[model samples]
Target: MGKGGESIPDEEWERFLREAEAGVEGAPEEPSARARMVARRLREESGRPEPWRGHPPARRQRGKGWYAFGLLVAAALLVVALDPGLVAGWFGGGGGDGGSAPLAVESKRPDQPPPTEAAARRPTVGQPFRGSPAAQWGDGTAGIGLPEARATGWMDKGQVAQALEKSRDFLVASSLDPGVLRGERPRKAIALINPHQRDVQDYLATAFRAPSRENDPVLLFSRFDRTKVRLVGDVVKTRGRITYREGKRGAVEVTTDVTYVYPAVRAAAGSDEVVRTIVRREVVMSWDDPAKVITEPGTFSLVSYKADTTNGGCATPTGYFTPEFGPERAASHPADGAEVDPYDRSKSMETRMREAGGAGCGTATRS
Candidate 1:
């Protein structure tokens, strides 16, 4: 019936017949387990085959209908070749899929794990890798423009000094500030409370150096790394008592409530750490207990502050600012606001000028 001896590919004939037959039922879900297993086995086997050493034998025709359809398509193609414009018009203007519009192609990137650790190491703690020095400065500074200074009249030096004095004098106050300290208990109480923490002794021994002999010779304390402090020889033994208080801003701060005794070099210009020892070290730790809705004083409000853990503690991190402005303070002072006095032209006067401008702020020039 077809006018040709050649047969069509089985797939093409099968698809053509399927479409031509029409009125087919939708595929069923939950295919039998046997069929599912067989399909999977077929898909796996499809990956490899025996190599053909020579020209393979031609495939045999399983049905005569394929040969007829093949001849019809061959004739149609020959006609289309002679009149491409006419074929295009009939098929809505394209070669692909009889001009039924090409399928929209989509490309998807393969699944990848989130770059969390890498991001953590970025220019700042927020990024993947260690950030550039400039980025670290900018981010750690909490977006405070460099050349920053305390805003005009923000913190009066006199007032700040008075407040600090009061803080220092709190120990002398006969009565403690009640309703201020939470989970407040003596050091002995902690051991009684958590008797299971075997490491508490180690923590105390290392964190707070207890006096060994009654009269270890006095040694000056100096700037030293905590890790290297244990190696110091001719150590100074001192007696001290520390107390913990939940800071007004939701932080657990250990303070030297009373230094019953402590060591110091008798030197006129004392550098305390000739053989430094930690007597009353304050560990500013976080209080993970549920926060309280404390109504701060009208003048100085209670605030919550998180330690600067980002950027390897090189700079401050989140939750350190006042509520209105936020928790960050600048690292340097800018001189824009504080003009130079004509009288002080000396190079040694530069530090004084910066100190005069602001207590703590950094600034950057506008680009």
Candidate 2:
């Protein structure tokens, strides 16, 4: 009786219905910011517009027709009781054909029409449908955090397409949100570096065989010897990826795993020489500020002994040392007692080399 169960007065129902019949498409009103964002995110992830992506809000616009109809039905029932003879005769079809005529025989309530299947499927008399765009996109929007998104109401088909376009360029590096554990957010973003084997080999050759170390004198037979030098043979590779949110803050997080085929090398150890142990490392780098944020030497960690032993040739978060960084050291010396560099070999390796060479008499060599 009331068109769409709206609160329109009886007189207004006729006008609105007439307008609808005249081919006017009803539109949903605009929604609030929170509602809009929710709807937007929903549509973006789903790849389709929700039924209420951007339509008018709910409010009473039809009331008179329903009220009048309810009164009419009540009046009809009252008339039946007031005149039992006419009412009973009318209902008692076998009594006579006069009251049992076709119109009277097929009598039904006149206040409202029967409900249809489509009408039943619609939102209840007072509620609105909150359509989800997710119902459409599925895995296509695999990286989206479903609960974090927002969208508007009364959306049309084109709105879904717009959401997809907006979502494509997003890159989330680190997901620090605790909500994931509580089922609040979905899909954490991860960055990856897929380096080829050949690429790794090239980097290793450059880093190991480029003859970059400074020339220094070593100790032999309790004297400083020029021929004694650090011998190193390494085959290494590197790659980068974004690991977490900070990575996405200004750069892409990358995981560069290096598997080296290191060869034996001899280094001066006071009166003797020895090859260093093989090494392995896991390096994490960021893409945006690649050079500025990671493994640059003394600043960002060049290598992290994250899951491997230090003797495994693993690098730590040490800054890169260039020729201009500092002066070269005099190799291990017997007089220095600890095969440590006479100039500046007090570092871990330098101290170890000196001690192993049996030259270190326990004198502390400050690097």
Candidate 3:
């Protein structure tokens, strides 16, 4: 047995037996980690620890003395088997049952205890766990695709957190950039999106297209018209954490609790009408890439997204967006024609909000 499975000391063994026979206090809480291992080994070696039911009726009269002697012999054999040094001492060897002397077993063995959770979760180069004190990326800062992240290790828990952060930044920038919204810089902002995140792509596309019906959600923001509303103040501030787990088939599911804040406007009307909208969004990012390494701009996709408009008078929707989990709606506006749903079979931002609003979601009015 390994050092961790070392035999219990004679005094501890006796005390344990005494307490166990008394039926008052149970065995001492496995003393230490190594002692816990020893306890497990004892169970394996001595069979079950159930009380002896005397040898059938044949040995019913075997005196208590014989029973006690039998137990002592069994304990001695267990000690000799677990610690050869104790057997050596029985024959006048210096090292015996003395607590001061070390066990005759080797201190180190080829098989050591299993890796601890912390050791298993230690972050790799380039992929530092977010805010982890133990993480040490070559550069003070660690980010996706940075030179330091080019390590050979697999992704850790921290990488998932970083990926969510990167994903959020990409989504916000793409939504705010007029060039990307209009077809001018289409692929530029979406470079970080996982290829499989088709629903996310469709969602962004339909959000900026021309409005089809009354209270068109896109109209609330100049319909991606930079001349109408200019993005001002700081970018969206995210306040939330992501929860992730290894999924079936080796996939990873990351749930994000995010709140987004941005200034929307009615610039074309010649009025400085800007409303700060705070949206609480819950979405899932699922990755199914076979690539060896996933960097900041790697293959991670937005599996699903649901956003609720919290700011009242914002004129945006307040319900679910993805058709897979919610309703269905569309639009068609060909450049000059005004009303255009960014994609087919998807709900408008307002439409989603309306659905959620019907469900009793809270509302926040603009100041």
Candidate 4:
């Protein structure tokens, strides 16, 4: 008993909508039994003869209430099939402002599958590290930056070489004292070390303490001396031997011995001082078993460093008068094929040093 003569209840209207929406394109074409009965009653009430002669009509005539109910059901279903939003609004499912939200019909592309956990966890290898080029650079050299080595497949001798190359490049870039002062060099370089090694952590911590309290000079210079030095422009040669040691509890130790031919030069009082140094480092990496790769941090940490230098490698330079001073004796000299005077100047220091037959200042010693 709504504004209309007789209105369908809210519950019945909702049911009609659900049914219509479920089978909008598959509704039966013929009228329902109730509808047919109602039609017969209308014909009988109007005093029209039945289509079937002689005997009474096949279906009993329905009351006006049944007729009204059947017509209402058909009308509600038709309206729902035509416009679901209007029915939803009529059932109080619309917004408070007398509007209804559109039906959210889901559609997915046929070829694309849903994402999975494994796909999300795929390793990012062979991809370049994207960051500020300056942040990646070692010792301010253009194009020389942090390592691009990511965890790919299993670790092998070749992969170890790539990691060693990153360390060596860091060293070459750190020849300038200014690069060491940047502080990022140590942080980035330490990323290679396994964080589980307390000894390595202690060593790095001791080396990078207060400005005057640090010990490891070869790794980080104790003082920022104006000694313009650069590694000689020669192919860095490396000889490594990989050793695997098995232990109890399924732990395996993978060790490597790497020897590097490091030639370098430092400016000393208008003369190019050649310093030939060879570094033999031992790296101990850990793996789960024979088949597993050691991808943990500090697995490739440097456990031992033995640097042999030809000149001024062990002692600090002595100043005659002011702070700006060089070594007393120019004794350490470069190897035969190494470059002595690579820096551009009016006169080449290499010529003068070569004529002098090996010029070096102090005895080269290990740090």
Candidates' lDDT values, in order?
0.27, 0.27, 0.40, 0.37
Give the range where candidate 1 is weakest over 10 consecutive residues by summed lDDT: 304-313
Question: Which ten-residue region of model 2 has the weakest summed lDDT?
Answer: 216-225
> What is the C-alpha lDDT profile of model 3 across 216-266, one tens digit per residue?
333222123344344333233333334566654565665554444444443
Question: Sorted on TM-score, highest at the top, how do the candidates line up?
Answer: 3, 4, 2, 1
TM-score of each: 0.14, 0.17, 0.36, 0.32
Residue 49 alpha-carbon offset, candidate 4, angstroms: 99
Clash number for candidate 1: 32
- On a 0 to 1 TM-score scale, where does candidate 2 land against the true structure? 0.17
Candidate 4: tens digits of C-alpha lDDT, residues 226-277: 3544443433323333444443334444444333333334434543433334
lDDT order, best first, reads 3, 4, 2, 1
> 1 or 4, which is superior by TM-score?
4
Candidate 2 lDDT tens digits, 1-367: 2346444365664555466567666622343344456567786885565454356434443466677889999998997666543454456331111333222111111233211111111111111110111111112123122222223222223432333232222222111122221112222321122122244334334533342222100000001112332222111111111122234434333332221111122233542222221222234533334344432211122122122111211112111111100112233222434322211212333234434454223222221
Clash totals in order? 32, 67, 12, 19
State the local distance difference test value for candidate 2. Answer: 0.27
The candidate maximizing lDDT is: 3
Off by over 4 Å in 1: 1-42, 45-367
In model 3, where do residues sit more than 4 Å from their true spots?
1-154, 157-162, 175-189, 196-224, 235-237, 264-274, 289-297, 310-367
